[model samples]
Target: MWDSLVLGTKPYKRYYEASLLTRYIPANSTVVTSNTDSEDLRSAVFKTADGEYTILLEAKAGTDKEVTFDFGGEPPVGKTFYKHVYQADVQLEGNAVIPSASGSFSTGAGSSFTDSDIDAEHNVIVYTTLPPQTQVEVTPLEPVVTAGQAQQLAASVIDNTGGVTWSVIGSGNGAVTAEGLYTAPAVDEEKLVAVKASSVQDPDSYGIALIRVQPAPAAGRADIPQFSLEYGKYAFTEALTITTATEGAEIRYTTDGSAPTLSSTLYTGPIFLTTGTKKITAAAFKGGLEPSANVFRLYKIGNVSAGPDGYDFLAYDGAEELSFTGTASIAYGADGLFFYKTLTGPVSTAGLFEDPNPASDDKRYYISTLIQDEEPAVTIYNAGFEMPVTSAYLTGPITNGWAFDYRSGVQKNGSAFAAAVAPQGTQTAFMISRSGITGELIQDINFREGEYELSFRMASRPSYGDILPFQVYFDDQLLGTYQPNPSGSFALVTTEGFTASAGYHTLRFSGIETPQESTVFIDDVRIRPKGSPPLPENPQPNPLPEEPELGPPLEELSNEGFEAPVLAAHRKGPFTESWYFNGYAGVHPNGSAFQPPPAPEGNQTAFLQSVSGGQGLIRQHLEFKEGTYNLTFQAAKRSTSGGRDHSFKVFVDDTQIGSFTTASTAFQPFVTESFTVSAGAHTIRFVGAAATQEATSFIDDVNLNRLDASE
Candidate 1:
């Protein structure tokens, strides 16, 4: 022990104590031992006044007190010593025990070593150490290369030596260079290649990268393949087949005149023209090749003959019956016109309006006279069976109790009385064939013991020119066996003075029982009382009367300006007002309502706001008797910006008949389109389809009027 002298006096005797100081010694190059205990000594940490440096110590526990540390790499050239000063967390009882003061040492040539002769304080001691990392990693662990292509590989190395070895693991898979450039096998390879990188200083540490080889694609053209098909008018019964000559190529087609792309429907077999005129487009595509050129073709079909014009009358208000001799009549709400021509013998009616421009067709409608039957009459659900065919391979039960039964002798895609095939003009019609296996359309009627007239229009499939024989039976009794001409023209077949029993009775129209070679199509069936000459009610006597004041032109139209039942004002957000809607969940009942501003010739306009990715609509249910009407409406986009635009699709009773889109910043003139509506209540919906969020649309000024296109 040593102590200072009291009162500034010299120490009684200079006490001597044993002290030890140690530090790391660096070598020209480091060669770490493989022994696991050597690693524990390599974890020693050291610090100097300037900064800190790592030192690896090697010593035997409890047996050796002096520690020797190795700092790999050559020391400074001319420096006499290396100064090291550091505090350390050297011991652990339950927690780490860090030294309060740093230790100091110097290591170099001619370094001094002292034993037992040192200062009483400032004791430096050696503790533990840690091993430095000496490993490398291969980047791009998995790389892809073409079968005959080359790719470069890279490695990241740390500590000891940065140099690495390059090699491939799989035989015949690939070759590698000294610089790590790997070339895939010239032939297509089905396996993967492993390339390795090993550290030169520590041969046991290594890294590996995986290489995958893919087969190269074949060379081919970049355009679509050409298809073969003729363009011309075709009969409704015509079956057309399209073909292509490209090998290993796929053909795609579209029937709606749209451009064909890779996602279009694939064409596999012959196509049968079942409906009206269509624009068929087709293209071909192959792997690694350009799509082929598109081929377009158009076809039109119409009825060969139509029935005579029928008398037209408008029943106004609640009139049960109306008599007229003219060719056309105008009617309003709860009123309609019936067209008919007095028949001297057999009367024929236009089966279906096949002409695309029906506004110019005069023989598409027929009405003999208005007859009010007390009971519900059996009417043909779809006169021409023009409803869409859900599936060609599956049968669909129709409304108003109409169904198709597979007639004998007709094969798959060739069934008699099949739906969707156009037999009358271009409109869809049910097929009826003359086979011994009888197929019939049966309907039960409640007849009040009266003489009734049953009439139906029939046409022969133009593909087959043979005559078709059919029989009509009432209550199991054969009424008549008639042979219809195979001219493709719709001709009326009538059987009158058939006595109907009271209560329910079945009326069966059967196909030919005896085998024949023809098929007939029937449409527009009507059952009513025989017509008679009109009886005059009463004649008024003429007397002197005073002239009345002139009034404004009579209001012959109903709701022509959409100016009834004024709608309330609407703004934005969760619209709630009149007009039915497809629904917006809890946000709004219909997603639109009536707005106050920007009305196109009206006090109010329907406003539709965007609802996420869905559509909004405003619809009205109108009570129309029966008439052909030309329709018109006005629409515009909202003033708000920065959102998707809105469009309109007009539907009548769930069928989309017309549509228009608007993107104007200001309101524009009315857009017009028309469709004929039969007598009944139908819902007309003006839908606003939003392309994105916050898109707004406006609509107003709706009009409907009787159309006299033939005149």
Candidate 2:
């Protein structure tokens, strides 16, 4: 029996042919049945002469009484077959035999018989070659990818041809090229993508890699705008166009000095601005993207106003009305007030009388000012501190019609009314002592239901490296606070727009003295009518909303860096549980006693430097339900007086946990520690360890994160 197996290769192909023409017959006998064991042929491994290539082959029944060998699917090239084929029941011209023999063939070498014989019955076997066993190894077993991003992939075969074909398993998942570069789809939905790499040498063998698709890129907030014209005044008309670089972005704009929102007017064409000054602000918006930064432009189309030097004003004194006519002038009575007048033309004035009533018909006064002044008014009794103090220092609360209240000390300080320092015509002025104490100086004044301006002269002597601060209150309502600058002469301090009803009201100068030794002097405390003094600018709107009423201090703690820098170390100020620094015994870090350390996370860090050897303490109040939380903070230490290690103990409420210490001046790595706070309000504090010498300890960036109860 004769059977033929063909394995052909193209001219330029790198593989050789895998064809064999086999002539198997009984030794020296006529051709008959050619039966072979199918199992043996199927399990045979075919290889080349040099064993460089291997393939698996299967044996099957061929037509016309012959056995055929099948290479799994297609005949693999670049190899020869040398495996033995089992023969059974061989018949040559009516003779049968039960023996088996081996046969061989090569694609380039041709078929060959193992032995030659004649006139004998014997089994004939054929050589078998196996198809190459190929496996593909893909790089990056699993990878995370974002939508619309491309990733390069690689595949290699183990002990076989390295060639591989790449493809994606499903539709709309993404696209992959033959070279293994995959490009994800534009959709943001996350999905798992299966990429396959099939071996070219073995069709049935492949490798799969899972690509984890992540969400789309984030659309961040927009950028601020750029203006074509510089911000300044111009005489001629100018055309302005609002533009943003973001593609397909729409610009919403406002020309009325209001913030621009999505519902504002959409900008399409250039804005033709003429005449008056206008403020143009614009913001960009796009679908699926965050709005761009806002751009602001102020265009002054006409002449811009200047400071006080811009105009001339005629000056007149009290009870003196000799004025050659002009539109604007300054009238000096008990005070100096700006007055504007409009007339047919410039002319000499008749005797002008000043009106102090809100509903007055004074022709010389501006109608607005005259109408505002029409309300009844009164002057404070002994407006200036001209009364003599009963003694060198105030021994009691009441003296010279003024009452004093101190935290713990007597009302004692130098008098501004003394002959040496008092201004030329002054006789007596009150000096309030500020020596580590809290106090208030007050007086009662009867007002007739009118708005008034309180003006005074204040001076202070430098003390404790800080200016002493004082607050003014009217009828228990805080009006303003004052910090008198240490000048050689007195500076004027004034507060306006103080309205009073028809009754007696208490005015006060209250203060909590600093650790420094300072004194506040008061003279010429005058209260006058505020008859429409050009109507002070509108009060600024509060940037922060009013905090909700929190029961039992449930509000979260804020301002980790002591908002009051003076609270650092042992220096005194108002210390609250939210933030306070004090020391006892011996633990103190050495640095500035009052100032914070250099380069803090925020404006300042609570720097506890050992001035006198004692334990330094810093505390914060926190309220929480029963829960576990992570406490994190950054700490730093330095040597100021001695090289004593700056160590501090951490505590939740009053119970101490572990301690932290660093000897270098640089800040330590941010550390996190866990602590459980039982239900209710608690305090987290850091106390410096007691040391004999000075060392500096710093703390900043304190945060607490709640954890799950099960964790």
Candidates in order, TM-scores: namely 0.26, 0.22
RMSD of each: 39.1, 40.3
Worst 10 residues of 2 by lDDT: 5-14
Off by over 4 Å in 1: 1-399, 407-429, 434-438, 464-467, 513-517, 530-563, 566-711
Q: lDDT (CA) for every model shown?
A: 0.45, 0.49
- State the lDDT of candidate 2 residue by residue for 351-396, as single tens digits: 4434533342321222110112222134343344433222233433
Top-scoring candidate (TM-score): 1
TM-score of 1: 0.26
The sequence of per-residue lDDT tens digits that candidate 1 reaches over residues 1-711 is 212211111111111111112213222324334222342233334444433343333333322233334343454321222222222222221111122213334444422322222222232333212133355667666666767788888876653556888888868877889898989885422345778888777878777776656444334543333324344443222334566555788777776567778766566644444334556677768887766556565655322112211111122222333322222212121101123233221222233112322233221233222122121133333333433322122232322234456641111223333322232212333434544455556656544556777766665666653556778788778878876565665566667557766556777767775555556566545565655222122211111112122223222334433333332112221212234333321111111121123455644455654433445656556666566666676666754333235676778767887767677755666544666777666666666655433456666666666675542
